[model samples]
Target: MKQFDVERPGRAEREDRPITTTTPTHRLLPHPRDLVRFGPHDGAHRPAARVAVSVLVPLVVLATIGHVEWAPYAVFGAFASAFGRGLPRFQRLEMQLEAGLVLVACVVLGTVLAASSAPVWLLVVTIGLVAGLTSAVSDLRRWSPPGPLFFVFGLGVSAFVPATASTVAVAGVVAPASLGLALLASVAGALLPAGRRALATAEGRRWRRGPRPVDGRRTVVHAAVCLVASIAAGLLSLALSVESPYWAMVSAVVPVVGSATAGQLVRAGHRLLGTLVGVALAALLLAWHPGVAALILAFGVLQFATELLIVRNYGLALVFITPMALGMRALGGAPVDVGALVAARTADTAIGVGVVVVVLLATHRLRRPRPEAAA
Candidate 1:
């Protein structure tokens, strides 16, 4: 049995490899240092600032207008700016446009479902389908974050929150405005002299080389994994009477996006550990009982920190992301039982991680070379 490399190729590349029953159990666990280690800065501040401004400006405006209930929709729309982080200006713009469209669609669907008061099962199925579809799309478009995590997240959170005809109309208007702002903010850097000079460099010209041809088979497999993982996590969370089942669904989708089994396990570990610590952070924040304006500012700060740390260390990013997410829910007017909320989120994340781990292991087992074939 060959040892699995931590940085091995993705599942698609390993499908034809000689497999064995004896797995490297050690590789299943991530090194402790890997969890804490941060990668190079690589100008993370630039995109971090873009995403923060995109989210902050809309939130401020909504707060000013005294329509903070619309903040969730705006936040999701601003998510569009988080894509295409390192691409050139034009490519980033194009990617953000596509992402914005997807985000807007998810928000619309979720809002409609919320207004209809759709059942839990229906929400599960709908989000699963969205996960699968968006997974394929992300792969085809070579999205940086890769997978349907944000799409499923947007749809699930929207559907979980209570909505009405009036609120739906509000979402229709607010979400798109936020998206447009995000687009402008994403490319606003181009106006700077430094941005213009960078664009003239070899790295900027690399976009002309075009994206690599997508592998349809791989895309199908990735989509299926995301769909099944999301549905399984959602159903399990519901069975356990978890308050926020979609958190489980979101966590499940995170692991499926990893490049390989070891990578998947690492991601799952990150998600679980991050959420746990984040839950504590969220609890403290909630205990403080920050005012609406204070919460909005905290949300912005957390968003900036999350974007800054995400690419470098996912687990660390979650420390900020968890609180940020809880704050967003509060802004959207979800009744906050601080104890219940944090407990449910923590439980939901654990369930999701467990589901994805089982799925990954089962798939790996099924794909392993048979004894006779090995002979």
Candidate 2:
């Protein structure tokens, strides 16, 4: 073997040599393995049970009272508490209460706008602006529901309901009913023997609360940009004569609100794929046109399944979510055009994902370079 020079660099030589550092790998999208990984099995059945009860009870009562038109209000209202499901019991309670308040405000506002007989364009603009504002608040507070999904859902669904002076009365009923039931259900879990341990843990942690690190200001900016983009995408759908522009707006919101750029990309893929499969299921359900009782049971089952699968996979959750939403809308008296709705939703989702990708690229370039200290 040839002899090699093994002398180490002198201190002066080492100091003068330019240091080469390894760059941290940051993928613009998740790896295929990341996309499929179901990292942990976190059982969410308790909260699922609560949500099913909360949603179904009010809906059943409204339908029984022949206030079927108001069922959408209660359904949307109850969804307010659907956030914070995985939190420690007391934290979940606090989070849901705050979320419920916000949901009430949003629901009431949507009702007012829908009742105003305003032009559709004005309504879209109003929703976009309100959603952006609410998203900012939600992020700053670190609320679990995150972003403007449910708020926009409430607004979009409410816009379809015939708004009158009586609508305010309906809102009063549904909003309170939703909030109260959700609170009761949320708290009820803590009374369970298993949940009691979590409640105690939360109690100990409650007073120890310190400032949680967050870039709240940056979050607000990102959420606002994302919401505005979603609105634009929704408007585009309307212009293109798509049947359900709101679905596009919702889809757009879903991706951009993800935890990371990689997460967002994964979410966009899940959204598109999930919605495609979901719409197929929805098509079959719509074709069947099941009666009220059947719809109620179906809603309950789907809601349970959605909760069960949500943590396991986003795509899986959407499969149930799509049919549940379509069923709820049909129940709320909106005409269902299964084929057109599915096509429009697919198109809108693609458009929304495109907007998110564009925003991500712009934001990436604008991000200030972090100063790296020498090792």
Candidate 3:
């Protein structure tokens, strides 16, 4: 780590501190090099496969029992199985449980709100607030999968659920059931050798559970930006008469929250590319008009591929993610509009990416002052 001292307007002389070089300082536009940079595809195969299995089993069971409407709920619950990826067993289990509960709450609340008579603007604001809170929590927890991406996804999807007694009742039942199943899968995942390693890591951390320094201000700003951007994107989507504005909100939050402007720009590009291809794939699949069995299988495979590629590249992940989300929607008994859905997704992503970029540019200079300048 290298120490640096950049000056601030009124701050007292500060002690030497390490400055992260991975992210560039106060850039108005993305560097050209960043646009071409891509993370290596280095996801662990076994863990990803486990996540797919965890999500798949519940979805299959729900579909087989003619509860295809509950498939999305199960998917939300199984989302926890994707956590603790590279962690030891006990830690992984704890991570899964915590994340699962959060997802359950997000899904239930989003569903209830969407089903309510609340104004569309209100719904958008509420979703943004929830996303901010989730972002803060995720940062504090240092969750592996990172950020409020899934939280936003859950809220966005639930926003579409029409407010009805039957719908609410279904949400009440299916949400918890899915969460429970995810928890079980988390425990079962420990049976593998990789799980043992994660357990050992957890034990080591437990002994040293001392506080680790976190940038509260940065976290808050990140959360706030996510909230504002998501809300803005959702509103824009509504203005454009898009059926599901939440997707736009979600697309904005994901790329804009954590990384530098350059990194976000790259990610935004990846999101756009992956989504376009994914939607095309989804259209092809929709053309087949597959039954519940085919949908279930496809969901599992797509999820598996997504987990495998997500960390390496968000764009590639979206290739599978787009179809999986569409598949979930289709199976939920909702009317699938391939053309509208594809268009909405692309448009919303563009809106979100643009909002986040603008926000980052506006706020770049507001970052904490470097001690070097003060000297």
Best by lDDT: 1
Could you list the CA RMSD of all candidates, in the order they appear?
6.8, 11.6, 7.5
Off by over 4 Å in 3: 1-43, 192-210, 333-335, 367-369, 372-375
**Model 2 misplacement above 4 A:** 1-25, 195-210, 332-335, 366-369, 372-375
Candidate 3 at 304: error in angstroms? 0.5
lDDT of 2 by residue, 87-188 (tens): 555566677888788777777777887788867777667677767877777677766656777887777767645698779777867887888888888777
Scanning candidate 2 in windows of ten residues, the lowest lDDT window is: 14-23
Candidate 3, after superposition: displacement of residue 119 in Å? 2.1
Residue-wise C-alpha lDDT for candidate 3, range 1-375, written one tens digit per residue: 010111121111010110111345444455545533454443346567778888888887887788777666667777887776655445566777888889888888877887776788888888889888998887787666667888888877776766565776777788778777766765664455654454454352342223557767767877887888888888988898877788888887776545455555666667777888898998888867887788889988898898777665567778897888877768866677777777777777777777776776676665534577446
Task: Residues 112-157, candidate 1: write the lDDT tens digits.
Answer: 9999988989999999999999999988887767789899999998
Residue 340's lDDT within candidate 3 is 76
The TM-score measured for candidate 3 stands at 0.85
